[model samples]
Target: MLIPLIALAGVLPAPALARGMDEPRASLMVGALLAFAAVLAALALLVQARRLRRRDMQLHARNAHLAAANAELREVTERAEAKARMLDGVLAAMADGILVVDAGLRLAGWNPRFPDYAGVPRRALRIGMPLREVIRLQAEAGEFGMVDPEAETERRMAMFHNGTAPQRLQRERPDGSRLELRRTPLPGGGYVTLYTPILAPAAAAAGDAMQAAFRQEWTSRIPRLTAAAADGDVAEARAVAHALRGVAANAGWTRAAAAMEGIEETAAAGALTQLRLLTAGLPQDPAAWN
Candidate 1:
């Protein structure tokens, strides 16, 4: 509207000039100038729109990347937490005393057996607790038996070098239970300690008596069977070999039982030659049997 009005106003002054017809040429120049300006404005708007569109696309791409990264981070965190929970559950369920220590010698974890053995509450355990303090507590509780301080220090040094050592100790419980303690190192770091109750005196004696009687019976039988085989008493040797085979198998001596079975088979087949060869290698002293 402004351009046309200006053109009209300019023409008003140029009516006398319009009679000569130079005004039409002047108006045509003005119109061309307006069209050029409009074209330039359209190009400017198009360029600006393209720039905005590109910026939006870039923002969307960046946002998508951020979302993917956040999702991956969340998944990693969840997996780590789940693993920690599982490890905690397993540690709590174990009957052995497990202690995890860092390279700095600070305690990282302790299992229930720690309190059970030390006669202390779990709350007393702390992250920065010293190894010496733990040993002292057990000693005061009478949990460590006959451990020489110098020997203990040497053993600890050995453990640091070798990564593990099994140490035996005795514990007298408040409940009157006698416990045998064994301490071993964990694979990667730290240590594990186990406490097993010693059998009662009467039960120990009974087991020893049973074992002695079995040993005596085997001592008398094995030699007689070997002698009978040497004397070519094939029938008596076969019977004795069968009995020994059963005894060996029952006692979890599978290899010895198999050898006895072979002897029995050869004897029963009347192959007295193989039976005599087998008897020749039999131990005369039961003490050297194993």
Candidate 2:
């Protein structure tokens, strides 16, 4: 390219030479300057091409990184969906009806069998509704005898919140089917209730096992309750007595229930010796519970 520029400059000088030597000198100088400008433009284009290639490579790398991130997010989503389905299956497969509520008593979870077991109208069931509202509807339907609906709802709510209260309740439907509800309060400020029909044969076998286990538990707890009461630890004694009383009442151990109540009261009154005496009176023999 430089050779061609020099040859053209030489021709321009030749045209000038035909006129005079002095004109050829000026024409040659102008031709050389034009060639230098063309070289500079070519260098600028090469620099621009290099910059474009570098930018293209960076974009490709960024696109690959985004694609990898998207794949990971999709995998996590799929795993979460699978776990949710498994939990739903477990709830659905249960034979008994289940109802779970949050700390605020708002309905948190329930199974299909809840409606059938509770005998509550399906229209009253709302996933996030306050459970007291449903109770009010049942009260209006005369589920709690002839009492005012609001009063009964309040009464039941109070019972549920009572730490010492027994949650075992028996209900006879209009069709003469007997069912039992057992509510277990969770440590995390919620409760789960199980509803099952009072079948004779199943109850007979299950009751024996449950009775034995509860008797053992109560006997073991008597010592802890005694220790708490003897130390005049009102909070500890009350908590132990409350738990023991609920279990005893459910097991139909009237004497044990009364004894636990006495421990709670005496500890609160600062009668440490009387509380110890009450704990000592609890019978340890499982047969004595009857």
Q: Cα lDDT of model 2 overall?
A: 0.75
Top candidate by TM-score:
2
lDDT of 1 by residue, 1-290 (tens): 34544544554534566567676786786677667666766676788899999999999999999999999999899968965774555455544556666555557777677577566567878988866666555555555455765556456556655656447778587667677767665577566556655779898798568656646666677887888899999999999987876655444344556677788878888888888998886863434545
- Cα RMSDs, all models: 20.2, 16.8
The lDDT of each candidate is 0.68, 0.75
Model 2 misplacement above 4 A: 1-35, 142-147, 160-174, 184-188, 202-290
lDDT of 2 by residue, 106-178 (tens): 9998988887776678777987889888789777776656789899999888876776446798987666778
Per-prediction backbone clash count: 0, 0
- In model 1, the worst 10-residue window by lDDT is 4-13
TM-scores, all models, native as reference: 0.51, 0.53
